[model samples]
Each structure stands twice: as C-alpha cells, then as structure tokens.
Target: MPARDGDEPSFAVAADRSQWRYRPRRAFWRSRIVRAVALVTLLALCALVILALVREQTGTEGFLVGLGLAVLPVPLLMAAFRWLDRVEPGPWKNLLFAFAWGAFAAALVAILANSFAVRWIATATADPGSADDLGATVIAPVVEETAKAAAVLLLFLFRRRDFRSLVDGVVIAGFTATGFAFTENILYLGNAFGEDQDLGDGGIGAVTAGTFFVRVVMSPFAHPLFTVLTGIGFGLAALAPRGKRLRRVLLPVAGLLLSMGVHALWNGSATFGGPLAFYAVYAMFMVPAFGLLTWLAVWSRQRELRTIAGVLPAYAAAGWLSPEEPLALSSMRARRTARAVASRTYGKAGARAVGEYESFATTLAFLRERARRGTVPVPDFAAREQELLHHLWERRATASPALSYAARATGRVWVPPQYLDYGGYNPYKG
Candidate 1:
C-alpha cells in the first residue's frame, strides 16, 4: 500500500494537516509565555520603583495607613467602568495592565520627570515659588497626562483588536487614571498624615481627614476624567479609515494636548483665581464635560446595538442565524435574561456557551457591516463567517430556546418594521 503512487498523495496530505495543527498550538503557547513573562517583569520593575518612592516619602506607619484608606474607592470606580463595558466587555487582563501602568509606570514617570523639571526651573529662575508655580501650571499637566496616555497608546498600537471604539479608550483610560490617582491619593494622604503627626494636638481637625475629604470623597474621579480625553483621541484614531492618515495621526495628538490643557488649568486654578477657582471650573467646565461624555458613550453604545439589530437580519435571511437571535442579542436585558435562563437550565457551561454565542453574534454582525463597506477582505470575511456559524450551530440547541424566552420576556420581537428609524416604539408596525 505504501508503494502505491496514488496513495502517496493522500498520506502526505494527512501528515501535513497533522503537523500543521501541533505547530500552531506550539507557537501560540510559546508566544503567550513570552508575552506573559515580559509583562510580569515590566510590572515588577515598575512596582519596585513606585513602592520605594511612596514608602520613602511616607514613613512605614503613614504608608500603611494610606494603603488602608486609599483602597476604598478602587472597587467603586472599577465597578462603574465595568458596568459601562458590560456590552462588549474587554478582557480583565487589559484593564489590569492599564491600571498597573497608571499606578506604577505612569506615576513613576510623572514623579521623576515632574520633580526633575521643577528642580531645573528652580535652578534657572532663582525663585523657588515661581518655579513651583510653573511646574504645577505647565510641567505637571503635560507630564502626568502623557504618562497616563501611555496605556492608551500602547493598547492602540499593540492590542488594536480590543480597542474597538471610543468607549473602550475611555474605559481603559479611566482605569489607568484611576490607578494613578489611587497611588497619588495614597502619597498625598500619607504625607498629610505625617504633617498631622507634627500638629502636637494643636489642630482640631487633622490634615489627613481634610485631604481624604477633598481627594477621595469630593474628587475621586479627577484624574480619570482628565485621562479619558486622551483616550477618546486614541479611540477615534482607531476608527479612522486608512485613507484618513492625517486624521488618524492628529486626533490622538490633539486629544493628548487637550488633556494636558485641562490638567494644567485644573492644577493652576488655585494660583490663577484663588480658592473659588476650583468651584468655578468644577461647575462651569468639569460637570458639563462629564455629562457630555457620558451622553456620548451611552449614545455610541446604543448605536452599536442598533447595528446588531439592523445588520444581523440579513444573516437571518440567509439562514445563518435564528430570526430571534439578532433581536435577543441587540437588547442587553435580553442577553442577560438569556444567560440566566441557560445557567438555570444547563448549568455554568450552558451559560458560558450562551454568552459566547451572544459575543460571536455581535462580532458577526460587525464583521458583516465591515464586509459590506469593503473594510474586510473576502477570504477573511468568509473564514470568520464560517467560524461564527459553526459555533452558533454547536450551541443553538441550548441557546436558541433560552434566547427565544429572553426575547419574549424582554418584549423584543423578531418581526419586521424596526423602530430605530424614529427612536420610538412601533408596536403596531410588526
């Protein structure tokens, strides 16, 4: 049999296929290991630097107290960002990396760079007070924002697949800034605590309590709000077409500059207009800006959901998806209901499969839109479509019933006549 010429081709093909499978697995694992090791080493180095800096500035007791108190807002901020990202939900690893960069690497860079710049200015100017003012108004903002923006820039260049839209940038930036702020709060609060120790029972209310009240309670989101402007730049740059080279390049730069300007204004407020400056900026600028960004994020999410609802019907017509699927996947409430039902019936595995089904379905919808726009290559489109269809097929028996139930419970009909056209319900249209 081995000697036969015709059989040789088949034997060779089988061997090639077998070899290809193991090769990819081996390469994938090797690459993953290398990346993991590199990331760990980098984070470890940053942690050491940041730890030494903080612990040196704040004594052991103050550092401990700061560490205990500084952690209070971390979970709340994390949960808020997580909630915003519930629709697409970037992997936790990306967020963790972003936070680490902000807390350690970014903070370290900011401290060293800012301190060096201020010292240089002091030496040149012969007036330490004015040099300090210049650093706060000019140096701090530019240095700190650029430092925080490193996370966004890294993700934009390296993890392009995950940094999809403006929301992703905002979330990643927010987390990074949050981490930076956490470390910064620890330093400030701890320093204030040290100052309180020198009060000798003279002051009624300690600086530590006042500092915590101002930073942690009143303005916990200050750093995140500043960094998110830069993130928006990165996100929009990602969305820009290849043809718009200037847009892609300039958007991020503009965003970084804007973030720096805002940060500078915030830092210089005390010097520029005294104590009322903070209140004026907070009311006249910060609150309005935050509100606008929140609106934009929510609106953008709605637009994405609408894309799913509108685009997937074509696939349904082609019999690649259940008619109810697009409707179910479009509604976040329905998606949650679907997962709950799957979990209740078929256990955690079923719930996980349903979640995958939803994600794959959303990805498929976006892919189709991209394909129609000629943004994706034909072979890639076909390959991805086939892959997504296969997964949906595998889980359809379990996921379909759950999704159908979700559609029913959530009052999302799979029938025709969409209401997104006018932004109002059209119950009679179906």
Candidate 2:
C-alpha cells in the first residue's frame, strides 16, 4: 500500500525541520571530527612549544621540578571557577574549548607576538633591558589579553545561547585564564628552579621559595582577575538589548581596554616603587577588586533565581506549571530535595526526570522574560516555547508530585494533591 502524501512525516517532522533548519549555524565547528583533530593539533603544538621553551630555559631536571610545583594551585583555581558556575551551569564542552584555547592557541599567540615585538623594539632602540621592560608593560599585556579575549569573543558571538548572563562570561574567562596561567607557571617555576640550581642552593632554596610565594601563594589569581574585566564587558554586552548596537559594540571594547590597563599597571609596578609597590597595589587594589567581583558573581546568581520565580507565575496560571513550582525551583535546596525524593521513590529515571523538569522550568522563565522584554526573536519564540512545554508535560507525571512534596518538606510551599478536590475557596484550609 502507498503512503498518503503527508503521512510519512507528521507534525513531529515540523519539530525535526525546525531543529535542522539553517540559521547561520556553525555546525562544522561543532563536528566531532573537526573538534578532535583541532584539539589534538593544538594541544600537540602547545605541548611541544612549552616543553622546548621550558627545557631550554630550565634544563630537564628543573623542568620536572617546575612541573611539580606549578600544578599545586591549578586545581584550586579551576575548582573555584566551577563553584562560581554552579547556579546555571554552561556546557562542559564550552569550558573545555575555552581551556584548550587559553592553554594552546592564546598562549602561542601571546608568546610569539610578545617575543617578536620585544625583539623589534630592542633592535630599533639598542637597549635590550628597556625593550624587555616595555614588552612586559605594554606589548605582552595587549597581546596576551587580546589572545585570551578571543575565547570569550567566540563564545559570545557563536555560542550566544550558552552565554546568557554575566556568570557565564566570568566562568569561561576564569577557566581560560587558569589554563594560560598553568602554562605560564610552568615556565616561570622552571626558570626559578634553574636559577636556584645555578646559585648552588640546595633543597627548597631562597630563590625557589620566593618565586613560589610570589606567583603561587600571593598572586595565583592575577591572570584570571585581569581577564575577568574583559569577561565582565562581554557579559554586559550579552545582556544588553540587541537593538542597541552601539552599546553592544562599546561595552566589550571598554572591558578589554580596562583589562589591558590593569595588566600594564601590574607589570609596571616593579619599576614604579619596587616590590613594595606591587604589594601595595595588590592589597589596596587587586584584593578589593577580586572581592567585589566575587560578590557580584554570587549576587548575579541570586538575581537569576529571582528572575525565574518572578516570571513563572504565568505558566502556573496556564497549567503548564504547578502553583508551588516557582518557589520550589527557585530555591536551589528545594530543587535538590526534589531530585532526592524522586530518586528515593522511583529510582534513577525519576531523579533524572525531576532534574530535567527543573532545567526546563528555568528555561521557561528565562524565555518568558526575554519575550517580555521584546528581545527574543519572534520566529524562534513559539517553537522554543512549545518544545519546552512538551518536555515539561512529559516529565510532569513523576517530577511534579515529587517536587511538590519536596517543596512542602522544605517549608517553601505546599498544596496537597488531595486538597484541590474540594474546588472551593477553602478559606479555612491550612
């Protein structure tokens, strides 16, 4: 029997079509083959470059020593950034790409460009020391920050959906800087180790200890903090109205300039008033800046949750969401409790359902807010809204009851399933 004209693919095909539709997509960039090749190529190049450079400067033994010492702070910095991103986690793929970019591509660009510019200046000026200082204070900061900024820029422009808020930018930037620092530390620590060896010093000598104290303990956050300014700019740009093209353009540039300025100031500190100037700047300026940024990141997460709570009431009115869900989903604790209760009662699938429910519900809130603000594209809104609604509807049977129970147990809100049977106002209901 022959199938009818429209019978082969129904409305499900509509969704499939939308999902596959061409929209200036950069799918080639996302292909596994391309990604794997690119990653291997970049990582190999960077490894070779860093390895040779470190070996040349530090010798094999010093390189090994540096590798050991430099790795101590890497995990802590990575963990801190991951912790800051807990509220609305971006895809790990994005993070991995950012890390790879910083480790290999950005570092490569910074080193090569800085070296060339320094040599050029030294040849022209006939003063190698002054050229080296100028390179550190001006050339290196601009080149390195711009190189690092490429990762954020790519995410901002190509991975727009992944970069919805300020925290996303901060995390991506932090991770990128962390990667760059990891490579840079290997060099610095290796060099310090070689210096100590040459000075006939044994054990953890004065030079090695001093370098570790300065780079690892006192200023591990230096790179991340400088680049965070650039991320902040891109983040603000992401949040701004797209129609305000001027704002969109200016914000990120401003941020990059600020990053460069601060970086130059940090580099020039040694020449300004010696090591005391570095400590003064670090204490009076950098520490406070770091604190303020941390506060801002945490505060932004809370604001995001509040935004979810505020916009979800309409879905409740339309029966897409329960009356209690807005509150339950908003509180991170309640969300966790819901997952736990679901898993306890119905096992892993139940837990997964509840998790997806929470995620879809959050997406719904953000979408509605974007639509209300007239920023959401008209062509995409209806389709995205329908897709999210369908997902929530599918998970509602298992997840809703569990989430509601969790909400009640957590003392956030409650409406027993039995209570609605009465249908009346129930003014006396507890």
Cα displacement (Å) at residue 257, model 2:
0.3
- Write candidate 1's Cα lDDT for 250-318 as tens digits: 999999999999888888886677879887987888778888877877887888899899998887776
TM-score against native, each model = 0.88, 0.88
Per-residue lDDT tens digits for candidate 2, residues 1-430, read: 1121222222341355446332334588787679779767877887688678767878888888888988899889888888777666788988888887887778888878999999999999999999999999999899999999999998898788888888888999998998888778877888888888788988557888888899999999999998999999988888887587898889999999999999998888965569899889989988998899889988988988999889887787766667788888888999999999999999999999999999888887887777776667866776677777767777888988887787788988744555554567655566
For model 2, name the residue pairs that clash.
Answer: none
Assess the local accuracy of residue 133 in candidate 1 as a C-alpha lDDT between 0 and 100. 91
303: Cα error in model 1, Å: 1.6
Candidate No. with top lDDT:
2
Worst 10 residues of 1 by lDDT: 1-10
Error of 1 at 124 (Å): 0.7
Clashes of each: 0, 0
